[model samples]
Target: MIRHQRQNYDWGINAEGSSLEGGAAQVAMNGDTVFIHYICRDEDGNMVDDSAESEDHPVSFEVGAGEITGNPLFQAFDEAIRGLPLGSTTVLEARGGDWNRELFFEVPRDHAEIQRLEGRYKNQGGLQDGLIVELSNGGSAMVVAVTDDVVKIDANNMLAGKRRIFEVTLLNIEPAQR
Candidate 1:
């Protein structure tokens, strides 16, 4: 693969200079704050996540750190984002990684609720269509499947099996203090 070159760097969200792009990327630096709007999608072109959810949802991050991009689509993003101007828009195709597939439990569950909900859902349809199960305690689980009398619900950070596409624009960047 061809090695891409470093481009421009900017200081803060309030740049007085005109927009920056490809060849003009020398203005961008690792420590410079970057303001961007972006959308992330799966290889099949389905929307995964996007900054467009709200006016304040655009992404902001230091140029080189790995915080905002722990997903498998990092390389494609790094390449596609190269030399993008402040207001420019870009789309990145990302495949889900293990980190995106692992389920996380926010609240502990006793075996009783698990058994009850599973048994109630057994041989039931509409599980995969999506069902929200309200726990006796606060919070809910999105039911994904029911089989062998087992209700297979996964609460993971990553949306499973779906391709995600993202539309992004640079919003703001603040380099962290050393």
Candidate 2:
């Protein structure tokens, strides 16, 4: 069964530490696919990138499976949503060196899809045409060539060297099986 909540609250802790919010615990475990919606802004409060503006707004990926690696933005997100509660919205303040920003995320308790990537396959002789392959670790690569002994693959994620802020909302959580 799936559940959802549409509420917004102040997740910040003031200097005096007066208000303390409490709710159910929702931790994202390994192998679980999480769906989220997000927006990003720079230190100067300028809108940098927003997932809500994309055609497939709210992207989904498996957690702790290295599905969305090579990107600093997603790397920060993986760290932020580790133990986030479902059906709640919170702001995350990330600071490193002179870079500081806030990420807002809303995680819904429902909505998820489990996808499994197949293992490597060896051709009898060799592959002549190029083929895109999805790795078992949830990563992807393009097969440039295949020979009797070796297979050449290009595993590069274009967002590897980019820097950007992100506002993410968790829309669903599929817990890993025991």
Candidate 3:
């Protein structure tokens, strides 16, 4: 009975080690796949976004080096949650730099799909009224307005006007299991 109990204790400790969340994460950066459920918020602690709390599809990334560059809203992930292990929940608040900047970006044709989903309506005719886009997490946005000549997708994120925060959990790490 004593031996069995010791074995169980070791197993529990090992399980904890497998869930550490600091260091260079072994994610799929080159054609690797990672499943994550996450949320976004402004610095003010207001709920700006939440995947677990949303109806939209969970954020899945290919885990590349620069795939997330367009969205400057990654300060939360870059700082505290970058090296987290799989299945770990990482809660991070957006830094001040992520806020206070209106990220004027040009929406490429490839990004048009998300643009349409975000209600990025083209300013056809003399429509001056802005459009509101709702994220899956019940966060509605007015930054992703579209124009006639180009899709003016605001990559600064909907919560750019305020600070940002995030709660991310690694649901799956495909490459590491293999």
Candidate 4:
């Protein structure tokens, strides 16, 4: 398990003579791609997700690039890690109710579209056209119903609609690939 520790540093002027405030010591800047490992838990203290289970689990995303914008938990994570230096570990809290309702509402509709496409596939077996799949962003979804021109899919994440706490560590930071 990764342990969390707090460190203090002097905020000195940068090479451009700009004053560094807050915890900006060797921090990630806009457009910087950061690699992080995180463990997330709900308010009840149940582990929802974690990247520290394996060395290969660290995830990378560009700061301020909207990669994690859709999820409120991730948005809080983005905010907490912004001014933190590399190799720093911090705990962040997020209220799931803070997520944009409209955005969450759209996910089901989008999943329905995916379900429709799955139903249209010719390789469906003798059973009804129902399949569960994992999304690229680590969510699981399943086709629950299908009709002539419509399909219903249920996609949900464990942390959705729950207050969450995240223990995150910034492992590395580099320039954005593009």
Writing each residue's lDDT as its tens digit, candidate 2 over 96-149 gives 322111211122212121112112333422223356555556666555554454
lDDT of 4 by residue, 1-178 (tens): 3333343212210110122345536787678888999887778899988887776777877787644467544555565566667877777665434333332322333465455445454375511335665555566555556555555545644334656666788889886655
Better of 3 and 4 by TM-score: 4
Q: Candidate 2: which stretches are off by over 4 Å?
A: 1-23, 89-164
Cα deviation at 152, candidate 3, in Å, is 16
TM-score of 1: 0.46
Best prediction by TM-score = 4
- The number of residue pairs in model 4 that clash at the backbone is 0
lDDT of 3 by residue, 110-131 (tens): 4645455534444443213255
Model 3 C-alpha lDDT versus the unseen true structure: 0.47
1, model 4: CA deviation in Å? 23
Cα distance off (Å), candidate 3, residue 78: 6.8
RMSD of 4: 10.2
lDDT of 1 by residue, 1-178 (tens): 2232332222101111234333543323455556666655566666556666866755555565433565434434443444455555555433343433345332223357776665666667434537777655655667666454555555643434444555556554453454
lDDT of all predictions = 0.49, 0.49, 0.47, 0.58
Each model's number of backbone clashes? 36, 5, 4, 0
Query: What lDDT score goes with residue 98 in model 3?
Result: 48
Query: Clashing residue pairs in candidate 2, if any?
Result: 39-167, 105-168, 106-169, 106-170, 107-170
The model with the greater lDDT, 2 or 4, is 4
Per-prediction TM-score to the true structure, in the order listed: 0.46, 0.44, 0.45, 0.49
